[model samples]
Target: MTSHTVQIKLNGSPLSLETSKVAKQADGAVVVRFGGTMVLSTVVAARGPMEGRDFLPLTVEYREKAYAGGKIPGGFFKREGRPDEKETLTCRLIDRPIRPLFPKGFRNEIQVINLVISADNENDPDVLAMVGTSAALSLSGIPFEGPLGAVRVCMVDGKLVVNPTYAQQSTATLEIVMAATEDAVLMVEAGGKEIGEEQMLEALAFGHEQCKQLVRIQKELMTQAAKPRWAFDAKEGLDSGLLEKVRQIATPRVVEALAIHQKQARAEAIAAAFEATWAHLVTVDHVADDAATRVKTQEYFEKVEKTEVRRLIVDKGIRVDGRSVKEVRPIWSEIGYLPRAHGSALFTRGETQALVATTLGTKNDEQKIESFEGDIYRTFMLHYNFPPFSTGEVKRFGTAGRREIGHGALAHRAISAVLPSKEAFPYTIRVVSEILESNGSSSMATVCGASMSLMDAGVPLAAPVAGIAMGLVKEGDKVGILTDIMGTEDHYGDMDFKVAGTEKGITALQMDIKIGGVSVDIMRQALAQAREARIHVLGKMAEAIKAPKATLSEFAPRFVTIKIRPEKIREIIGPGGKVIRGIQEKTGAKIDVEDDGKVTVFSSSAEKAQQTIDIIQDICREAELDRIYLGKVKSIKEFGAFVEIMQGTEGLLHISQIAETRIRAVSDVLTEGDEVLVKVIEIDGNGKIRLSRKQALRDQPALSDKEKLKIVPASAAGA
Candidate 1:
């Protein structure tokens, strides 16, 4: 194979795809470069399908090397470990769009690997990797019904920007990643700041046009270096008569099982129907009862079930749970369910329920992430956990998997839009959602529970947020969009569209189509319907908690922020951190000082917090002219005496200013370790302080008893 390259100008940058230069042995390989960032994508398929496989065995891996960003790994091994959260998310971003493009019944094991070879730290490589995956699959001739294109669109200053750089995305109010073919959109994942549905539609349309341009470029590359088509024939392994018999035996019973509203009951009924169907075939028809025959029978039974479920929705307008197409399920919620937690909520919609808790910490609790671009610290975090018992299953517990990460990321994005700024809140927040029961849309449940929990914890959110999952059943021209879809609807439906936001507009959205694609009009309708459902959910949530609590929980820590001169930071920290440590130890408080002299103290008791604040203020206090202080004489000299005024501050008492009359020596009026009242008579430009005892004696008679009592001795001031 010889090297072939194609280039185009996109969004004011040179975008290029080159092939046959690296990994030639793989079925297909492409290196995609945009600006200074580059991603190498390769696809390889097994020669034969895995035995007994019933689904597509596809795996997508994305890795970022430290050298790509001109840095080395941080750990002791000095090498990359497992994929971090960002890499795992990017892998899911690349896999979701292309996975549906493969033909049905094609069970070949395919692996797609994307490596970030160069990172300029401006343009993100995830979108580029998505495009490269589609191009590589198209060029591989792996029966992929594609040549799709992907683009990132961001709305900045009321205008949409295509393929915006990382800096542009950071400031944009709305950011959307869309993938599409020439005619229709295939996938969409987006997060916004309460953007309206119409605005989102316009952005999606704008991004699709850019996708078409990339599709053309991929087609040109295929013309130059595409491989010959691989020979794969999908066979119906079951005998025609046996399949017909199984369908007849299972269709009625499956429909009866689907009528059951409860998830557990429906599952048991379905299982019984499957067993009865297989048993009847073996006894009444004298059919063979081998393992292979049982597998075929089960496959046929599932097909019948899927067909009947879709028929009930599309033809009869009757869902499995007997709800209208646009009706949302029942909702109930409670706040402050846990007395000890900072905030807690139990949100249940239909059969799905989530128990969410919110915890608040100081700046030290923020999560630090190392990425190709740079290190990032996040003050707000949301974690979603799905236990096996939630769905009535028994399984081993391990670390979070890809599904949990993806779901948590979606919910995190949804609730992030309404959170208060770090400066306003001054506390690190973590929200954890535990799924107690699951029938459908547990991720959306997490979103609702988190929002309520935050409000119950007294975290002032801009607005309440809620999420709903919408499903679609399309049979040719007949289309049914179901609101608040359950697990059964999601499994057999053609689309799973999750929308989350406040009453104003949408904050996060994710859509995946199982079929080839859907038109823009269908998407517009879905969004409109989702908005209606989202508003209804929000109304129910408001009934539980109208607004954030007036006061934080007693168990939560109290925070106080104060600003001081930048130079005074060293004074607060002291040499070897002894000063700050002393303050914390004395008052049972935690203090964090920023470089710009912003000090935040956290404590459980208000009196202790105030004590800590008073200590910091005294250490950072400056001498003021015309103000009098009680001073301690530290030393004596022939020319002048240095008197200690504020903590860590001293002033020079000139021999002449020491008394009303001229003194022969400084020790005549003041001795070492003597406490005397002095007034700040002058402050020089170089910060030299001059104190006079004669002026203090004249002002002492005019001072009120309350003002005199407010003054403390210099030694006691530091204490």
Candidate 2:
């Protein structure tokens, strides 16, 4: 057997990608083992691009079969078909970091696959897959500027740990998985127990420091097995000569043109300048101008719009909205914007607007998440919808595309930071954000609108969170950072780093660079600037509506829960849900029970919830007894007789303890319902009360002990 290995220090430990018997058919295959877990990754690129492709046709698939841990499929007719939630999330992790690393305009039909071969119970498959993909891509002759590496960092006891185990992640206050090149951060996804901003930044830095080593391993593998990368027919860049003309003509006038600030006024002035400047070239005398001149004239006009606008921002240091670099556009928000929605909010930031609606439901509404771990439940989910009309374009709205899923997921992560814990709000929450208008950062607008809609539904958020999109245009340290960037700035700028966060720290960040990679110093500066703008956005949100209030809508359910002993839980919820269903049917309420023996009752009305609570308590309540009762014999024995004392309770009356009248055969002494005043003597472990007809007479002191003893002895002798 031929064996090959590529080793590098990762997270301060020796890491290796060993190939011997894994994925033998692939163009380039390697088994990446991290800690105790392992993933087999293969990279294969087709001879050419899939015909009629626009963007780089890259496909990343991560699979976790049940047999990875030697387990079988659980349900009937077992087979794995759909990717689970973990698989979906892991696929995103791989796609995000590597998508940017591919050389721009390299539209090749490239596929990178990571299949979990084995999963040691303590290790994470996601982290290992990330490492394996980078290694495979590096060795596959793909024009990847990668060797990008990822690490999962979490805070355990306030100390950040590198590449934490699955167990450590559950209890950690922070869960951060970030990828980085040696020079700059490529991607980051973090959510947790409200980690501090400084700590999150520190975690990112630590993760990057650890990931550098894995990236080194990729470089070595590339040197060993890589083929010459494919070439792309590069297209000409923007015309500098024509752009210079427009910049010269429009740079000065932009200040006065944009001072009007309204979109209509500025667009008119820019349009008039374009028409008047090139009137003669397409005049009646030369209506059929040559193709080159016509094309050049059109290109000149396009440059005026793209460049002069940027030049206005760069040289004058002024924004098209007439604000300074650090300034944010105005914000306006309102809830109950739509009458039919269960809950709705209209969030407008500058020109971007989102009408968000929230709907809550019973367990039936829960989303079923299947992962490598198997089936799970997602009680809270957020979906975002963007119609072409949002951008004033006419198009069909139907199924969700990758862009929609990606955008929605970004917003989902941002507000997930402050969503009420399941313990506090048990309903399955679904939020849908409709992009009513778009100028820039529609996804960020979704984040703001979703928060407001949740509050409108009376969901108690940890705090109100807000998102702001920050852009940067840099050429050799002559950098301009635009806060709350608009559509035009985002198009012309080199970087669009969207940061969505709360006052505490960042919740979600997504950055796409038009230029290669931004410096770490710029990222830090962007982070700081994003933080300030986010705070202001949050403040404005609070102004419209503060944190979620205590009262839910009248149409919403009222929740009340009671904690009881775990053992008594079954009795409270009687046979086949007879007890619980009875309570709900009787009071028109809903109930959810937890394994910890907590019963939560929800109802449309408070009265209905209280009524259900009363019934549940009665079913589970213990009875108290003090007085004696007349009992009848249910069965006979040599020494005693079983008697019926209460509706559901039984008592025993011994033969010797019967009345002074001597009698033989217990049936002759007492029949069912013979009504004898019986005194309670003792209750046994099984809750059976012992009763004696003669004991009732002993309470009278006038009857001496000798008389009582004589009476009992006679009865015993007869028995």
Per-candidate Cα lDDT values, in order, are 0.90, 0.74
lDDT per residue as tens, model 2, 412-503 = 88888788778878888999988988888899999999988988888888877788899987756578998999887887787878888888
Residues 1-719, candidate 1: write the lDDT tens digits: 56988888878999999999998888889999999999999999998877777789999999998888999998899999999999999999899889888876787899999999999998989999999999999899798988899999999888899888888988999999889999888899999999899999999999999999999999999999999988766564547798899888899899899999889999999999999999999999989989878887887788899999999999988888889899998999999899899999999999999999999998889999997668899999998899999999998677888888999999999999999988889999999999999999999999999999999999999999999999999999999999999999999999999999999989999999889888888989999999999999999999999889989999898999999999999878878999888888999999989998889999988888998999888878999899988888888889888988876678999998876777788866666777778899888998889998778877876653444342344455456
Query: Which candidate leads in TM-score?
Result: 1
Sliding window of 10 residues with minimal summed lDDT for model 2? 708-717
Q: What is the TM-score of each candidate against the true structure?
A: 0.91, 0.78
Clash tally for model 1: 0
Among residues 3 or more apart in sequence or in different chains, the pairs in candidate 2 whose N, CA or C atoms overlap within 3 Å are 84-370, 85-370
Q: How much RMSD separates candidate 2 from the native structure?
A: 8.0
Runs of candidate 1 with Cα error greater than 4 angstroms are 236-238, 625-644, 650-719
